[model samples]
Target: MFTGIVEELGEVVGVTPTAQDSVLVAVRGPLVTSDARHGDSIAVNGVCLTVVDVDGGVFTADVMGETLRRSALGTLRAGDPVNLERAAALGSRLGGHLVQGHVDGVGEVLAREPAPRWETVRFRLPVALSRYVVEKGSITIDGVSLTVAEVGDDWFSVGLIPTTLALTTLGTRAVGDPVNLEMDVLAKYVERLLGARPADAPVPGPVAS
Candidate 1:
């Protein structure tokens, strides 16, 4: 699991395709790989990928077909910056919400409005995922967790502080750029529970006389 907190802004060094429908991705993230080893999980742009090899400050991971189909990672190329975050350790503070590093869907930047202190960026929300987004709710975009500042039928906005604009990949995003999105897991769980029969509902007794 990840906390959706970006540890470093890493760059894609290389992308090599394999015989099967998979690609070997090498990323340069000094901070994330300072103590890294094989078999560790890293969240790259909101997708949880297992470390295949670690050399110097660079780490390589294989992106399978399913992940490519579901995320914006497939569109990445050498020199593209990515938000990087190591898995959250046990007993650590939950800085962001519970993030599975599982991309729910992909969205595109619709607009960006810069303010004196912060900026509000609007993104086109997928029709299927729009129901989960709410004003003031948490959402993860490209591995960085942010709060929903406004919501519409097919779009939502988030306020980005200077720190976020300077430290993460979102800072470089422009209109029409695609981003990976993961809605709050708690909302999905609540929806599931509400749709199912309640555990507290009494079983039907034999029709009373």
Candidate 2:
């Protein structure tokens, strides 16, 4: 599990495809790499990846076929910047929320506009995932937790403060760029529970009336 709080902005130093339909990604993240272990999990751009190797300030993780197919990591190239975060420790303050570091779906940045002190970014939402998002709800984009300021049928907007724009990868995103998105964990759970048994579903017969 993760908090969806980006701790470092790492750069992809190299990408080598493996024979098993996985790709080895070498990233440079001094902070997150400092104490990383061989099997520790790291959230790369919101995708939970296990540490395959670590050397100095660089760490490598394998992106399996499933992750590549479901996330924007496949679109990344050498030298691209990515948000990085280690798994949340036990008993830590839930600064953000319960983030599985699982990318639900990829979204595209539709627009960006500057405000007096912040910026508003509009992202094109995938229809299948729209039901999990709501106005004022929390969403994780590239591993950073953000609040949804507005929502439409196929889009949602977020207000980015200066800190966010300066510390995370979203600050430099361009229009049409793909981003990893994870909807609210609570929302997903609630949806699942509510959908399990429909209101019209017949209840168990009471006795043998």
Candidate 3:
């Protein structure tokens, strides 16, 4: 698991196609790759990718066909900047929110409104994922955990401060650019649990031990 806190802004160095429509991507992240070894999980732009090799502050991982179609990682080319975060260790500070590095859907940058202190960026939400987004709720866009400043039926806006704008890829995201989106995992779990129970199911009372 990850905290959605970006440790470094990495760059895609290479992309090579392998068998079964999988592409091996090498990213340069001096910080994240400092101690990375084979099999370590690194989140590249919100997608959890396993480290296959690490050499000279660069790590390579394989992206399968399913991930390519689901998120914007497939559109990445050499020299493109990517958000990089290493997996969370036990007992670490919870800086952002619980980010699984699992991209649920891809969204597009709709518009950006700049303010003196911060910028409000709006993204087009997928119809299927729209119900899960709530005002003031947490959302992960391209691996950066941000709060929902405003919400509409098909879109949500987030306020990015100077730190975020300077550290992450969202700072330079242009209109119509695709982004990996992961809604609150807790909300999805709640919906799943509610849907699993029968309509007439009774709520059991607490039992005294």
Candidate 4:
């Protein structure tokens, strides 16, 4: 699990083919690697990846076919910047929200409107995941937790302050760029618990303690 707080802006140093579809990603992030060991989970742009090896400030993680097909990570090339965050430790303050580092789907930046203190970015939501997002709800984009300011049937927007713009990849992202998106975990859990049966469907069995 993660807090969706970006610790460092890392760069993709290299990508080597591991198998027919899996690729080994070599990333360089001094802060994230300072205490990283083999098997440590590091979120690279919202995708939880286990460390396979560490050499100096560089670490390698395997990207399977599903991850590649579901996120913008596949579009990354050598030298591309990526958001990096270490897994949250127990008892740590949840600075942001509960981020599983699991990318549910991908979205595309539709527009960017600059403000005096912040910028509002609008993204076209993928149809499959649109039902989970809500206004004022937490959402993880490229591993950084943000609140949805507004939501439309097919789009949503977030406000980015200077710190976010300076520290994360979203700062330089342009229109049409693909981004990894993860919706609120709590919302999904609630939906699953409450939406188990149809409204008109009769309940079965007795309640258990």
State the C-alpha lDDT per candidate. Answer: 0.95, 0.93, 0.96, 0.95
Candidate 1 matches the true fold with a TM-score of 0.93
lDDT string for model 2 (1-209, tens) is 99988999999999999967779999999999999999999999999999989998999999999999999999889999999999999988998888999899999999999998999999997999998889999999989999999999989999999989999999999999999999988998878877897899886677985
**C-alpha RMSD by candidate, in order:** 4.3, 3.6, 1.1, 2.5
lDDT of candidate 1 over 1-209, digit per residue (tens): 99988999999999999848789999999999998889999999999999999998999999999999999999999999999999999999999888999999999999999999899999997999999999999999999999999999999999999999999989989999999999999999988877786778875679988
Worst lDDT 10-window in candidate 2: 200-209
- In order of appearance, the predictions have TM-scores of 0.93, 0.93, 0.97, 0.94
- How should the candidates be ordered by lDDT, best one leading? 3, 4, 1, 2
- Residue pairs with backbone atoms closer than 3 Å in model 1 (clashes): none
The parts of candidate 2 lying over 4 Å away from their true place are 198-209
| Candidate 3, position 88, lDDT | 98
Error of 3 at 8 (Å): 0.2
Which regions in candidate 1 have their CA more than 4 angstroms from the true location? Answer: 198-209
Which candidate leads in lDDT? Answer: 3
Runs in model 4 lying further than 4 Å from the true structure: 198-209
- Of the two candidates 3 and 4, the one with more favorable lDDT, higher being better, is 3
